[model samples]
Target: MFVSLGNLQTLYLHNNDISSIETGTFSHTPRLQRLELYGNNLTSIPQGVFDGLNQLQYLSLYSNHMKTIPPNTFINLQQLLYLYLHDNEISSIPTAAFANLPRLQQLCLSSNQITHIQSGEFSNLPQLRELQLQSNQLTSIPTVQYQFPELIHLNLHNNNITDIPANAFSNQPKLSTLHLYSNRISTVSLTAFTGLANLNTLYLYNNQLTDLPDYLFFGLSSLSNLRLQDNDILQIFPNTFTGISSLTYLLLNGNSLKTFPSEELSKISSIAVLYLQNNQMATLSFTAYDMMLSDVSTVDISNNPWQCDCQMVSFRLKMTGSNSFENQITCTDPRHNRRLLKNINPEDLTCEEPMIVRFEKGDDNSVEEGETLHMVCEASGIPTPDITVILPSGLHETVESGGRVIVEVNGTVTITDVTAADAGLYICIAASPVGSAFKTLSVDVQSKEPATVTSAVINITGKPESTLGSAPIFSLPVLLGSVIGAVAGTVLIGCLILMIWCKRKAKNPPPVPDTSVVFNNTNTTATVTTSGHDQTGQGWSHNVTNPGYAQRPAAPQPTLDLYEDVEPPPNRPTSKGAGPKQPAKKKALKPPKRNKAPHDERPSPPPPRTGAAAGAAAVYANEPAAALDNLPYYQPLTKN
Candidate 1:
């Protein structure tokens, strides 16, 4: 079908509509070194079609309608170094279809419909360096089990690979660049790139990665450029880039990072260009800005929800003096939406509103009267807010160092010797140019109970200088002791008075009983007589003073008439001098006095009527010394 052309080194047949090629048509070109058959309508290659082209070094069958390749199709083309079969309808390749091509260096099967490749199909290609299988229906990485020692580049992007298993590229030690972007890759094993010591560039963007595993790039020390943008990456592991020290370019934009990746970037200090735009970051800290701007030469952090508050003061200051940023770092806040970040002044970077951090004590507090009270109000704002404390007495204190109520500069309020008047709501106002924040505290001051003798002593003796304008504090025990002592003393005095009265009454006995006379007959007359101070016919007499010396008035001598059951003559009256003479009275006998019992043997006086009085008596009796000790000694006040 063709004449012999042994010296032809190249042939151009691309961009033609050739649908079929006759058998033995390329048999005449024995020494052909290059053949361009791309942009053709070829469907299937016949068996042993290239058996005569042993000297062919380059072949182009790309952009064709080829579906499958015959067995040993390029077996005779042992010297072939470049084979372009990409952009074809090839679904599957037969076993050993490309096995004998020992000198092949570049193989392109990209944009094909190949699903899976059988093992050992391309194992014999010892000189192969680059393989392109992108835009295929491949579910997993091919040629992973086989070693491509000399292969330098591999493109598996835009595939159906959901996960990169451990050591997926371990066989490709000499690989410098890998293309795994635009895949369904959600997770990459930590050791996936273990043997990729020579890897320089990696593209894994536009994937479903949520996070990068720690130490995932441990052995990739030579990696310089890593693109992981346009991913669902929420966070980067702390040690994910541990050994990637040579990294210079990093693209982490278009992610779900809520915070700046400072720790991860700290590991890659050599980064020169960084892209962190289109993230979920609301505000950046000063530390984050310093870390980002210190070493990176070019950084793109735009399109983030930047909060232009006090937190962005440092960032604004740094941007104000620099001219390196070209893109507009727009703010998303309502106050400065769509405004460039560099245009905002540092002094104008006030917070949306003043924030009250907290109160040292709770909002509702309690304190005892005459006690020191302290409360702290912590607040934060952009313009260094001025703190003022409003007292319950409607007094406003901005800065106080020494007084009954003091509000310190650090938002601390101290009130010495708190009284009932100090109990109420205290308001802490933190005002700034932007806004103000208020914190209210309610304090209940419990009034002290009435004091006793001991309480008075303690109050007089307590430190007076510390609580100058406030009430003096009293102790509970002192108050209680004073009350008890006063009660006991009253009861003791009453008992003593009663005892003295009783003793005086017992010492003097009533005058001797009065003598009475009775007459049974009408003719008899009788006169009464008594001893001791004029008893007057009465039985009992009380001479509280000197009863023994007093004598009763001598009554007339008693006369007795003994008339039994007989009426005497009515007119028979005895004359005053002629009356019957009274018999001489017998001498009165004096009673002997009984000796008093010893004090120890005497019974205790009936325990002073039981109850509060009895208890007080018992206490005073049992602990007389203690009661005496607690008694207050009065001293006359001097005009000192």
Candidate 2:
């Protein structure tokens, strides 16, 4: 096949039907500097096929049927500078397939079925400057990790990549151009291109991007072109273009943007070309119109559903004399359908007066103190009107007043922690350029009642008890103990009173009986000793004339002392004279038989005789029994 062509410097075997080759096909071409085997039907590459081609600097096996790359296929091609294996059926690259190619500068593996690439597959090629991997089946970009520090170009467009992760291209600091368009990229990390400081052109168009985050290009100072068109981007943040100061072209066409990035684009004074066509925008703001006329040179904002209402009058007036928007801007409103914005008369863009539809005049409302009050003041008009709520303090506030009252953009007022000072007439004014309307709400903030002091005073022991704000409650155990204590104190007071009354009755003694008795001196008036007389002083008498009385012996009487001054009886015989009157003999007194007394008819005790009458009765009771016996047989007279 090339057995003797050792000085071959360039060989073109492309566009042929060469499918099979021997292992030593390139062994004889040791000085070959270029080889092209593209547009062939080669299905496989044998190991060590280019073993002796040490000076091979260029190789092309593109548009072939090779499905895999052998690890040692290009082992001896150390001087390879260009490799093109695109438009093939190759699905993967071996780890060491291109390991020895130190001088490889450009590699084109685009338009292949390669779903992934092994890490460090192209690490040994320090001089690699361009890598084309577009129109492949790769789902995501590989993490190069500075493997190709000297590389300057990377093309990965039209792949199945779903998302661009953070620092996806950080290793490629010198990369000036990145082609990531026409992929399935729905989300891109905020720092996806953080280290691509020198990036000049970025193509992110024709993807599923919904929105661009703030500071997404914070460090891309050198970026000139940013193609974000043909995506589902809804809005571009205000700071999305903060660091791309040199950005000159911005393509945001064919997206779902209802509003333009006027604030973001106007800040970048270097933007030259602006594409906002085929979007859902109804009208552009004044800032966007001004930016288009002064800062941007080329502006294409056609094919949008423009609403030519009162709000679009300013934009239409600004576009009156400009021919750049001759047919690009048309109205979709029924009043001016398909009419060019520059052709419409400014006077026709009139609006109705703003009318407060939600709140009525003199709407009475009340709120308790320390409560929240929400009042809705909705209005309707051609253009949205600003709301202002005049507070009771005569202060006019639009959004918020101090910290207690807040007004939302949708015309709702929130008064939190309302106090008595917040009560009064609140006038809500909805004003716009066309006309103004208002609604009044009389708010009555009921003040809270003052705290009261309640007290309970109990005088249990004739002393003041406890005072409290409210009646105190006692537990069952405490209440039982208090009741028991009260009962014990009452019982102690009764017992002390009884003991004092009993001690006052023991101060008097009983009277003593008389110690002496007397008798009569005459025999006719003989006295009997009767110390046993009844309480009435009646003496007992025995009649000896009766037969029954003579049979019984007479009872002896108790002796009593006779008075020495009395004379003796004349009938008595004179006996030996007693030296002194002998004391009368005593006898034992018998206990008196008392008649049985009724239970309730006890006889009253006789009052003790304490005067001289008691002494006379005692004097007649000591007479001897012989003298009293003769007198009693003869009936003696009773004493009065």
Candidate 3:
């Protein structure tokens, strides 16, 4: 019961209870360019369903019960360009199901239950320009290498895709608009858009992406609108949006971003509308707003988890009543969590007090007498404070005077050429609109020399020498003169003893000689002369020749007892070579007398004895003894 119309170019079979697309159902229509088979109960598209339709250009198969598309289902439709298979129960497509359809351009497979796509499934469709596969059960897209140079738009929303392969859209050079929203995508590879040269619009909202790679939008030069809201994006690279110079609108609300990517996002000059609500942003840094100053016109930054601490006080003041953030901006946390900033006036927002200011000085306090007192004042505050100084001499001035003052915003001061007049209490005053504080400074000037006493000379000459030992002669003049005086007194006592002996000799009388003699004279006459000078020269030359000298008689030799009969024992041992007989008795040895005081006193105190003195004494004691023994001895005077 099949109609055989081999010349048919179009077919319409919509709203029918068709259970399946039978094999060879389009066998007679070899040149059919359009087919309509929507609203049917078809469960599957059988193998070889369009085996002979080689020039089919349009097909509609929507609202069907087809669960799968068999291989070679559209093998003969090589020229087909538009295919609509939306609202179907299809879960999968067989490999090579449309292998020969090289001219397929617009394909809409939306509202299906498809879960997977095999590689090379669309390898033959090199002319595909528009692809819509939204509302499916796909977890990922195949990494196909086909170059669809005419592809301008791709819609893959409402899917379960969790990941995107690197460079998945590289070969699509003409892809300008991409719709990938309402998916379960948590991550995107940077290379996912490697070759998308003409891509301009991107839709990535309602996903689960927590972080974006640095170069995720690198090659998309024509990108203008980027939608990435309703995700868990906690952090973004500082240069994430650098490549998209044409980007104008950016949506980033409903994310967990505590900070904004000011470095990367600010480079885009065309950005006008920015959406940044429902996140955890506490406060906006000045650097963040400074980056987006080119053409930003509107921004939505509400519903954030902001903390209204003291650090935010300055920011609150800056944002309130300011033209920079008057109508388009609002705070999204703290007391004004959901309140419109336009409704709340700037004067109504109050700022909290800042932390206390802490000041620090240098470590060393020893300032030079005439040098500058270099004092540094380091303090920390929310809004920097103004510092003033009061000098010790009651001179008040700012820290800029070169005489003894200099100040800085970093809390440092230097005082120059500080003198004794500059020593005393100094006060440093740090003030702000909220409150003021003061600190005391003390300075001391020290003197430079050691203390001692001066005294006159005190003579202790006649006093006994100290038992412990005399002090050094060079110690002081008074002590040295005392030692010299004691030594001179002992010399005077010895000179007096010699004078007393001479006086006693002058008072004594002379003794008389004996004149009785017996006969038996031997012609040896004993001559006696009263005068010391005898002109006859008979009494042993009694004339005294030397000046002031007395003449003395020669000593007598001992007489020998030759006549007495004595033993000649010693004469038997005499040798022929002996020159002369020795004297029988040696003269009695005299004991050395103690040195007198005047002669023994040295001209100067002997040099303190050291190792050099001991060496000199040893040399003198080692000399020959004969030289010392031959020295003449002094003889004593005797009375006759």
Candidate 4:
């Protein structure tokens, strides 16, 4: 019962049990604008089914059992603008099935069993704008030239796409929005969107992309909103969005990124909202926020796996102190953790073990004299471990040299001023409350001088003296010579004494005019007398008297004049009357003076002397003059 209807602009044949649509089914309906055949049990679309319906603008064939479409099914329908085939059992489409549908604008093929699309299947649909192919088994989109030139929206959600081919949408210059969520896309090619200049929104959530390709959106100059949540993206390329100048919103939550590409993405001045929550990032670079500028207001980078290594300790402090970073970052791993990074204290993120701990000798093999061998122990530990050096002599010393030892946390010790006695097993012990370790060092000492003895000594003696006793008997002459030598020595001593006495008398001579004077000898006393001299050298006699002798008259220029007129004392004897029993009278005398003046110019006479005085003066005169030789003399002046 195939009936032809004229001037039909709409037809409805929904909810039928039709299994097949024969060719030339609508060949007479040239002005048909709309047709509805949904809810049918169709199995296939035969060729030339809508050949004469050139003015058809809308069509719906949803909830069918069609498995394949024959070629040239819609060959003459050039004015068809809408097509709906949702919830079908179709698995394949002929390449030229829509070649004549140039005016098709909205196509809905969602919830189908389509597994593949041959190239050039949609190349002739130049006016097609919106396409929906969600919930299909498509592993990839075909890359055909001029396939959908006016395409503005595409929906490819819930597909089996593991890889996106390069330039997949190169022919779609007018594309603005694309949806590829819930797919198995593990990688995106750099030219995935190479020709999509008018693209604005891209949705790629719930995929398996481990890394963003370089320049992934380079040709998407009009891209604004991007959704890439719930992926296995561990990292992002440094230039992921280099040419996406119009991007303003980006969603990167629920990924495995250890760090964000904030620096690279922020080059787009129009970016405002960035969602980076649920990652494995530990720290954020300072340049990350600086590039965002004023256009960015919110950033959600919470739920990430962060580590508390020393290199990131400072960064952790900064993120905890600031409101923009710490408050937004959340810990996702090690399940028993806080919601926000700011809530977890920094002290809780302490390091567990030291990085390096060891000892090194300056010269590992040999040492020399006067050269100090250094033993250096270095360690790096958390909270600074204590370092100490134990010498072989049971002594401990602190490290001070700059290069020999260094303590990152107090686990460094150095020993200096090495000596031979210090050559033994040296130990460097590094200890902390947590644990301790030790390193052993063997020191070899070398010296030029032996270190055994301190000093040495030597002694010597002369031989015995020789003798020749009874050879010569001429000893008399030798004895006589010895006596003569002794006499000559005595005479020489007497002469030396006399010379000394004369020198002393010359230095202090006796007075020439005094009457009474005293002199001393080595064994006796002596006295001197002199009378006043006359100018005429006449009648000016000088006399010297002794107690036992008369006064002696002065002779003319005589050296000595003595007269013995009285008897000598019984106890004393004169030189002429001396007996063996009487000692000779000892006397000291001065040489007689020579007169050169007359008697008229003589000095006045001296006072007379008593007998007792004369006796005392005589005793003084008889004494030797050797003892008085050193005394000074005085002379009286004569009156004119």
Candidate 5:
């Protein structure tokens, strides 16, 4: 119907309810340079929608329900330079979809539902400079090799892209900037950015990269600014930024970097301003800063966990005095965690001597299993370096040195009764804020005979016994326990011997000593003697009387003496009614019974001396019984 105005230069049929377009719908608009049909009821664009509009340079089909972009959809509109297909329901772009648009400088499909695209889908757009496909459902680039020789800026940010395959920009000689930030990118191929010779800026911040490999940007020679902040980067290789000499601004903020990349930073000379803020770096030292990069305008190492300790604290103070890192540096350690580094006084940065650690100055050691192992490590530093031993089991053990496995306060590791499981490489770390040193000691516990270990002593100063030829020193507790055990065994043996002797003596008693009493008439003495039970001989004598035997009283006691008195009744007095009974014959005294109680030992009296003179008998016949009773007590000898 509008064919009457044949040479229409611009067609503004936007906000239309165009549900369908006939084949020749725009045949009469061949000279149409701009087409504005956005906000339409069109579900899709017809194949020949812009058939005769070869001069159409602006095509705005946004706010449409377009589902798919077919190949050769714009084959005739070679003059189309700005195609705005954002805010559409476009799911995929087919191959050769934009092959006819040779001058399309900005093909923006942002804010669309595009998830997939065929390989070489944007092949023929050689003049496309800025291909913005950000804020979409793209998980990855459509193809590995994107051939855009004239494309300068490619924005694929805010997409669901997990990876950018290798050689994604293989032929992009004029590509200067690339924005792939805010993606789920966890990995990038080694050659992913190998061919970007003129790429000056790259924004890959906010990704899931754990490490940056060496030579990642090998061919990014002109790369001046790189934004890799907010990534989970824990490690960066030695040569990660080797060839990127033009890297003036490197934003590595918000990472897990504990140590500085000194080697890589040394190679990058043009890094005028480097951003290493918000990392796990414990301290910033002069050694980490490259002296060659003196021309570096500034290096922002702020917001790092700066441990203000003796370890290179002097150097940190020196750097704090310089204004190059003025306002950008702040501490994250105790007492000054949020304080600025420049505000800390240089005098407050106390330091001790550097540390030196060694394993008694020896090489790898070997020991037999089931033997005592004494390993010694010593440190030389101010305020004494604290020692930690990392065992073969990968467990860090603080050597408090006690018991059988004693560790001396000066770093001596003594392991008594070491087994095969205790064999391994032991790393001794002598660390302090001043400095730290490490020594590796490989202990090979061999399974051998004798169960004896021959380990040399490494003394207090870490002097190896190989040179001194000294035995390994035993801990006090170990020696004490051994001596105690031996003494207890000896005491036990002595007690057992004593008990056996006692039992033998109770079973068979010793022979009784003979008791013999002799009376000497010449000396008028009666003697008593006792000898037994290893007792010395002893004697006591009593005097026999001339008329009557007057004797000293025996020692008074509860029990009777072994030889007590036994007197017969006095002879009956002669009377008229009683015939004079013959004088009772005087009985002779007999020896007391052996093994008898003192009260029961009643010895019989002996017969009168045979054939004594009749006159002598007449002297004793009147009171013979009385004479016998008058005799001195004849005490008997007692045995032990």
Candidate 6:
């Protein structure tokens, strides 16, 4: 075992047949700083083999058969900075194994059999700047609350890590590059990267992420490139990319995304390249196209299941105008299926004899004033026609099947919770690539009436032939029951609507009138309490405490006066319920009573209290929108 090399500062014995290092073999090399024993047949390193190498800073033992690292094997190597133990059979890093190595900045334990690393294993390496634990059997990163302030790069790719907890990268502000791709990560907390303020490159591709959490990238404000391709993400929340405002390249290819992340992408103006290939999206929504960025130099929208139909007519025009990705996009549906979108003509995109298909309910197309109308226009075409409905009120609603009204990709129109406001002629424009068909459906919303006139007064505008046809015979008792049910449903629905309206009004109360305050004395400043919590220390009361005002003589002093107590408006309940009606609390400090002598008076009311005016706006803290945000995140209203 050659233990006589005492003054060795560097030793290169790599690619050797050494199967084992004897105890005390390195006892003589007290000043060893660089030790290269890589590509060796060493199965085990003795406990005290490196006990005397206190100056060891570089140790390369990678590509070896070493099954385990003995406790304190490198105990005295306080100067060790670079430890390369990758491509080895080492399974786990023992607690305090690399203890006391203050200068150890780079640790490469990649390509090992390590399944778990005890918490305190890297705690002693305070100066660790780069850590590589990739290509291992680790199912998760060790739970550690340590702040790695100096760490810059961390590679945990090709592992089995399933989840990242909140503040997973805590306090590593200098960390700029993180590679966690090719892992099995499915869930990440909102604060997973809480302290990664300087992170610039993040690779989470080839994982199992189904949906991105809200504000997922909130801390990486310095991030420039983000790779999240090859995941199962179906939709992105509006502010998922809250951070990374300066991102230039975002890769989202090879996912299940059906809707484009227009809102999130629009926040980042520096985005130069955008990848959205291989998704379930047929076409971009109107909002997405409206916010299309100009700085995007390259866009990859190819490989998606694009439906080239009438709804796409407008989008096709935009797609054609977008010469950058025009040739890349293609249709995945009938007729034009597999055809390049750029090659399709605008005249070729129209509907084929599109006409209304009267269904069971609303068969005659005439619906009750309160009942919903669900209708579909059947059109014979290769690619199904897209339906766009225009209401009588000049409101052009592009139907994509949602909301109080929904337009499905299959030319179905649904008007949920309809009312008299919806009674009018609705023009349904069914369009495909071949041609378009316009059909006018008149909706005569009938009003509620007595049992005797229910059949006679009910207007029917769907078909003249159907209305002229024989009316269905009904018994007197059936007619009575129908009328009773109609009245009951109307009353019940009206009550529910009223209750909902009252609840909303109570949750977000309107602002009260301005409470003006005039400070006649310049010797003191008043700290106005804007929060209306109570009467004394809190409330709508303007507290004017003038310690100097009390010094004035009592006679002819004009005390600061307040108006009458604010009463709750009609049918409005106060926040704390009605309190005992008493004199409204006003500031005790008062201005000198008109200075009795006219010569001493300024002859005008003081300027309006600017402070009171500004503070009034934020007095109500429990606004409905703020209260609702704590309840649940908003889901997609509707998508094409």
Question: In terms of lDDT, which candidate is strongest?
Answer: 2
lDDT tens per residue, model 3, 595-630: 324544433322221111111011112334344233
The candidate 1 region of ten consecutive residues with least summed lDDT is: 609-618
The candidate maximizing TM-score is 2
TM-score of each: 0.54, 0.56, 0.50, 0.50, 0.54, 0.55
Per-candidate total of colliding backbone pairs? 4, 4, 5, 13, 12, 15
Local distance difference test, candidate 4: 0.66
**Which tens-of-lDDT digit does each residue in 174-199 have in candidate 5?**
88999999999999998888678999
Better of 4 and 5 by lDDT: 5
lDDT of 2 at 117: 80
For model 6, give the 10-residue run with minimal summed lDDT. 631-640
lDDT of 1 at 245: 91
lDDT of 1: 0.73
Candidate 2: where is the Cα deviation over 4 Å?
352-640
User: What do the candidate models score in CA lDDT, each in turn?
Assistant: 0.73, 0.74, 0.64, 0.66, 0.70, 0.70
Candidate number that wins on lDDT, 1 or 2? 2
Q: In model 3, which residue pairs have backbone atoms overlapping below 3 Å?
A: 167-191, 372-417, 377-411, 399-406, 404-416
**Residue-level lDDT for 233 in candidate 4:** 82
Runs with alpha carbons beyond 4 Å of true place in candidate 3: 1-10, 20-31, 48-52, 145-147, 285-294, 305-640
lDDT (C-alpha) at residue 580 in model 3: 33
Residue 480 in model 4: lDDT: 68
Candidate 2, residue 39: how far the Cα is off, in Å: 1.1
Candidate 5 Cα outliers beyond 4 Å, as residue runs: 1-4, 13-23, 142-145, 288-293, 319-324, 351-640
Model 2 worst lDDT window (10 residues): 611-620
Better of 2 and 6 by TM-score: 2
